[model samples]
Target: MDGRRNGRKASRRVGPPTNRRRRTGAAAPKDALVEAVRQSRAATTGSRVVELMARRALVVAARQLLRQHTDRCTKCGSTFVTHEPAFVHCHYCGRMHRVANASLLEQELFEIRMGLRLAS
Candidate 1:
């Protein structure tokens, strides 16, 4: 039996056997997944905060314009007022002033835009 006559050939393309240990009880993968979830939640919360801030800014601007248009308290002639639902209350005299309907504000804004266009 010549050595060349033996037919078993080692495959060079085969990878070496691994001595690496298998993962234990999915705990390591779970930690990575938990971190990913936490990061995604943080990103969403940041976006929500930005959205809330924009809405607050719009409300403040509208409130300022309304206060300017009605620049005096009819009861006490004082300008100090606080906004409530569909009304503005005088702080100095405990009087309630009825604001126009919300749609009326939209109409007023439209007329102001038209006036600016005509002016230009």
Candidate 2:
């Protein structure tokens, strides 16, 4: 036998292969939520409801990202915070913290979030 121990053939294992369909070699999505929204939009044809829902989902996602990214104030450790293009302001302590210029992706998300807020 070829490379078999003690001249014994390998036993045939009997069981379902573990996650054979799972994309082990495929590149993961940059943002799962964003990719999900894209898929949802793509799955539907021209429909006003779907378009509105997609926008709403994007706004909600951006808000969540902003919240996670700005958890507490640096100056006074306050949780009440707001963000602008250049800085983050702590509402509770009235302190301004300069934000090291956001990435292009971040800026786009912030713009989407702020646009929604400003529109309403």
Candidate 3:
């Protein structure tokens, strides 16, 4: 009866109990789980921010490429043009210009007529 059971002495470790409640002091299990969830959510939010920045960068790069490869209007000598399937429309001159790279079928079907009269 010298504090020994089955000839094996008890553990000599001197510290608080292994239970989380006793170590944390009055914090419930639900509170600890909630805290862990909050930390994980913060990490997820950080990754989402990085992904959004990457998407914005890609959008900016696409816009730059479009600006570089824009077509100029031959009718009005204007660079501000809207690209269509078979032709490009010039906003400055109000004229629909034919595209040189269009297919022959599209070229014949969508003919570029004279400029439209703009309201003064």
Top lDDT model: 2
Q: Among all windows of ten consecutive residues in candidate 1, which has the lowest summed lDDT?
A: 60-69
TM-score of each: 0.26, 0.27, 0.26
Residue-level lDDT tens digits of model 2 in 1-120: 474767787666568766556557867676986777767854465445532558878876554343334668866888898766655768998876655545656655676787844533
TM-score of 1: 0.26
* Stretches of model 1 off by over 4 angstroms after superposition: 1-69, 103-120
Output the number of the TM-score-best candidate. Answer: 2
Candidates in order have lDDT scores of 0.62, 0.64, 0.62
State the lDDT at 53 in candidate 3. Answer: 58
The parts of candidate 3 lying over 4 Å away from their true place are 1-70, 100-120
Query: Can you write out model 3's per-residue Cα lDDT over 1-120, one digit (the tens) per residue?
Result: 787868999777679767644364665789888888778966658754443558888886554332222477656678888876556678999876554455655544444432232323
Overall local distance difference test of candidate 1: 0.62
lDDT, model 3, position 111: 44
lDDT, model 3:
0.62
